[model samples]
Target: MRDGTDHGDQMSDVKKGLLPGQLIWLWLTGVVIALDQITKHMVVARFDLYERLEVMPFFNLTLAYNPGAAFSFLADAGGWQRWFFTAIALGASVVILIWLARLTAAEKLQGVALALILGGALGNFYDRLVLGHVVDFLDFYWGNSHFPAFNIADTAITIGAGLILLDMFLGAGNGAEKKEARKKHD
Candidate 1:
């Protein structure tokens, strides 16, 4: 009934349809994609493919390109798989961005997770479609055991995946709506 209260409710209703934070999330996601691509470009230009530069006892920066999925799986499939992977990434990115656009700004962590995934997906998709492979550089190992060379994009995607999993397990009841519903019932 009050003026300020009505305005606040209107703002809340507007946010329920399309939150401002989602745009911020989109921008951040674009930044991540840019950073990932630029870093990969630098690595490709600076180092020869598969050239390892040991920076730490267990860490190495190198240039490696993978045509397939994680741990180089299906990398030797006669090169037709690059386009396949690119299509998959592009499709996934579309779905993620659409979902992000519909999500509320208050779902910060979930939005962040989705944005990271979107950026990472597009980053790798760019590489696969443009260069026919995904450029990787960060490497870690302990003697004979190696943990596979990966890049910033891959790391972001991995973290995003973890966050998605965490949200699935924790976000359900802990979400704002559920809390509000509980309060109303109480």
Candidate 2:
């Protein structure tokens, strides 16, 4: 019942594949990585290792390093945490890449989140491998309460994490995706 043109069209669609169209998300990842690295590089060039510049009443740009995990956890453990954190980030990067490969382009929520997390992971990984620590420059504080300094990579990672949570709770990314998944279960 199909003509030669119809068959050709079908073949073309099949040949287009799933991963090629997903390159946009990869480019988004590249942009995040570039911004994170550029901002950190500018901060390092302008500020001393521990110098702080008050950017506003509630914010400050400070040059600090975290040799450990978030909020300086285990930051004083000498040097072992460096390798430990590095390994974790690398493992996460691999997992995100695998997830992205499997995800469809229509899954924008998860796609964007995965891309952002990928960029953040690579940005921090670069810092860990080269500088032996992650850079921290964005500092926030209240009248007397202060928050730990974090970097652009940390910011992206946080946003990505939030998006992932939103997607999971809202059944977003693709409505039909959830429906099909539920149907498979039933």
Candidate 3:
């Protein structure tokens, strides 16, 4: 049999410039955005503003809009919030794209976080640009207590942020991994 050089050359041929593993995260991002928009479209078609359809004891489908940040922060502030939030989301999307391009194949956790964030940002950005507000439909409640209505985009962002926090707390970054390796070696 030949030496390992054959395998190295084959790998180099397969990985011209872009890595397949890196692009997989971008595909997941696309799926997230597609799901977010499709669900939002369904909500808009089936529900009117403030209209609620109880889906379960603790959940409902409600159509609502927010022209501001998370939990409707600055939602009441004049129309400037729309542009402000859009700009933020756009900037975030660009940053996430660059970040994703830089991630290595093994940084799956970070990749997932960035993709989720990018997908969510694009989803909301689309609404803000075309509708002047973010469409929210998912409603969770118990008795009289209720959580704010949110859409898939919001869910993605929240989950992405949570994953980022989890990564930080777990010390899964490159520095931490290297530290662990050194400790094991010593």
Q: Which regions of candidate 3 fall more than 4 Å away from where they truly are?
A: 1-19, 172-186
Q: TM-score per candidate, in order?
A: 0.82, 0.83, 0.82
Q: Model 3, poorest ten-residue lDDT window?
A: 9-18
* lDDT (C-alpha) at residue 75 in model 1: 98
Q: Candidate 2 lDDT, tens digit per residue, 41-125? A: 9999999988989889999999999998899999999999999999999999877876666555556798899889999999999
Clashing pairs in 1: none
**lDDT of model number 1:** 0.81
Q: State in Å the error of residue 8, model 1.
A: 29
**Candidate 1 deviant stretches above 4 angstroms:** 1-19, 175-186
Residue-level lDDT tens digits of model 1 in 84-106: 88889988986786567556545
lDDT of each: 0.81, 0.83, 0.83
Task: Give the local distance difference test score of model 3.
Answer: 0.83
Using alpha carbons, what is the TM-score of model 2?
0.83
What does the lDDT come to for candidate 2?
0.83
